[model samples]
Target: MAGVGVKDLLSADDIDESDLFDVLSKAAAIADGKLPARTRPRMIGLFFEQESTRTRIGFDVAASRLRHHIVDISASPGSRLGKAQGEDLEDHIRTISEYCDLIVARTEHVATVEEIARLTHLPVVNGGNGIGEHPTQALVDLFTIERRLGDVRGLSVALSCDPTARHALSFMKLLALRPPRRFTLCLAPETKLSNVAAAAIDDLRRCGTIIDRVDNVEATLDHDVLSIQTQRASSIISGRIGEMDTAQKIEDEKFTLTAEKVLRNRSKTMIMNPLPRHSETDKSCDSLPNAAYFDQVRLSVPIRMAVLSRMLAGRRWAGRSPSRSQPGWPETSSPISSSLSRSVN
Candidate 1:
């Protein structure tokens, strides 16, 4: 298996089928304790401009397990780089890049990560870029799906949530990049791919992903994987301030994932959620064998370990082979082309 073969991971489109497979294999190997430890002692900057539980903890634990020093930065009033202090984000990124071998950032704007990657020579991995993309989360997700199901190619995946969820969007783009031989994407009736994501959705269709707009949750549940992400229901009032508008309480039974729904297809279906979950999933369903959301969270460690290790494997400190020389962006004709191309320019 080769390295990720790129400097930065700004979107799911950054990785192709081969890279995806390599990363997944490496993740499994690392989890099994078969892979060698990273000899390099490097520093990783984990910077967050938004609140997170899974993405933040997963990366922190992954980097530590790989034996890298971590510099955790949060945009808070007590911190020097706090937005309230009127600190320039670019300056902060540039200063941090000078000290870290790699930078992983979660920001409320897509342009923030793009700008950081553009300004820094260090590899920049997007933790979650506002409503734009959550590439790393997507990687963990695909790794989990493939691990549990034997393969992602030709799998039946249903994404149920508000279409605006960045995780859902990034996962969709990932599926588009190396589409299955035969795939079915069952989307909720209220969930439609955003206009900005139209290009990627079209690419998936061209690559053999059959799109279906299912009107009922039960209809979507009869698949190999059911990914539910309804966190967008709680609107963010101020991301930096950690203020969120309370979500309107919904009594719509159809939208909820009760134990009954999980039992309906529990024998073969894998239930998933990139969660700070609201009412989309029922707690009663958590005990089911097919309820894989916890496994998804647990696997985030090894998956991210593979990602960080592969990205930094060739660093001078790593004492390994020289980094492969590849363009920052994929060829214009490739499906995995960088989304940062226009923004960086």
Candidate 2:
């Protein structure tokens, strides 16, 4: 399969269906230790402007497995940054890309990722951009779903809470590229969905997906997969912090994924979350059979390893002995990740 270049991952929509599947297929082989293990000196530069656990750690671990050097930078208030000193974002990107092979960024502004890609020669992987898109997270999430349910094409999913979640938009984008059997967005009427999210829904509809918007929790819980995302506006904005009640309509105590809902689905259903929760999903669900979010977290390492290997070790992946075992590859799996510095494996 042809490789995804620097510009192919700026947005979820930017990913080609074939290349996306190739990434995913490579991810699965890497996950099972069937693919060539990546080796070092390959570097990935990271720039983050927000707090993250999985996005940061996952990419770091993945890069380590791929044998890459990772450099991290956080654009926080106390960090010494040219941008902090009134430098333009483009200048920062230009200066950093000189020394790095790849750039991974997590910022509230999608334009930051785009600008970095435009200014730098390195591959820029979007971690999360406000309510824009979390492409890597979507990759692992889809991998977990495929691992659990066999095929996503005929499955049903209920995307609940946080209409503005970038990961949610990415997930929807992935679904549209292929599609689930049926999918529903379970969000409050007042919930703000991003333009990307709206476009993803429209794309899914065009792909013959049975997609719906539901307000009723009971109706929303009936799907085969239940994915939860945190409210970006409430988490990122200072005025919205600790205001979960106002930001989300799901009840703090009762609206959670209780054992009741899991049992009601009857058929095995999975629940997923994109970390740093603010009372939308219950903590107890972590131990349940339905919790695939942790599995999604687990797949992040190998998938990222595959991505980094493909990007920096192109000659290695190309010249290495061919493994005919990876069948029907490009249409199957996709994965990616990020860090706060230059660390990438």
Candidate 3:
């Protein structure tokens, strides 16, 4: 199989159908100890502006297994680059690029991640850039789906998640490249998907995938795979965050899934979640035969290790080469006060 032919993992567009298949295959090979691991340990910068559990740990463990060193950094009051210190993001990125072989970053704003990539020549991996994209998780997810159900070409998938969740958007965009047999979205009735989310659905349609939108989770039980998360019920009930009335509770429950609902519907769909879950998925559903999330998280290690090895060895991915090449923003003395910096601010 060919490599993931790109300089960085910035977005889903960085990969296509063939590249995704190769990644899944490579991950499987790595898991079985059949692939060569990176020999020389390089310094990796794992920077995050957002709180995370799995993505942060998964990359750490994967680096250890592949024999790389991670320089962990996060946005906090004590952080030299954080708002508390009022340090410039670009200056911090420039200093780190000199020390690290590559950088993996997760930020509250997609602009921050893009800025980092633009400021350095070091290979950059996008680790969930706000609600914009989370291509790495998207890759792990498709790997999990294929491992569970063989091929995704003809499978039907239902997504019950925050319409703007980074992982969900990336997952749907990746799915568009392959065009599943059916794609259903279970959204809170009052929710409006972002233009990015809607664009992914349109891409699916243009590529011949069947699309369906429903307001309830149970209505999508018949799909072959259900990738779910907490719905936006609070947004529907107007202003209050801490207050939940009977009507809001009722609205929230409609988008949640339970063992009873699956059994009552007699649906054999494989259930998946990019966890750190809330009430959307009941605890009872964890023991059900259809639950695949635990295994999905477990698979994260191997997939990440595979990706790291591929990138470290200077392997080229099979995806199309980017038509445009941007090598950092042009130097200006007043760069911090520039137009680009304000957009992210």
Best by lDDT: 3
What is candidate 3's lDDT per residue for 188-271, written digit by digit as tens? 555566655666777787888877777778888889999987674223212234554432353377778999999999989999
lDDT of 2 by residue, 190-265 (tens): 4545444565666777888876766544565567888875444324432354554665555533335666666665
Q: Please say which candidate is ahead in TM-score: 1 or 2.
A: 1
Residues 188-280 of candidate 1: C-alpha lDDT, one tens digit per residue: 333434453555556777877765555446766667888885534313412432433345344246657778876765546788988877677
What TM-score do all the candidates reach, one by one? 0.82, 0.80, 0.84
Of 1 and 3, the candidate ahead on lDDT is 3
Stretch of 10 with least lDDT, candidate 3? 336-345
- Looking at candidate 3, what is the lDDT of residue 12? 76
Superposed on all Cα atoms, the candidates' RMSDs to the truth, in angstroms, are 7.8, 10.4, 8.7
Ten-residue stretch with the least lDDT total in model 2: 336-345
lDDT of 3: 0.75
Candidate that scores best on TM-score: 3
Specify the poorest-scoring 10-residue window by lDDT in model 1. 336-345
lDDT of each: 0.69, 0.65, 0.75
Which prediction has more favorable lDDT, 1 or 2?
Answer: 1
Give lDDT: candidate 2, residue 139.
79
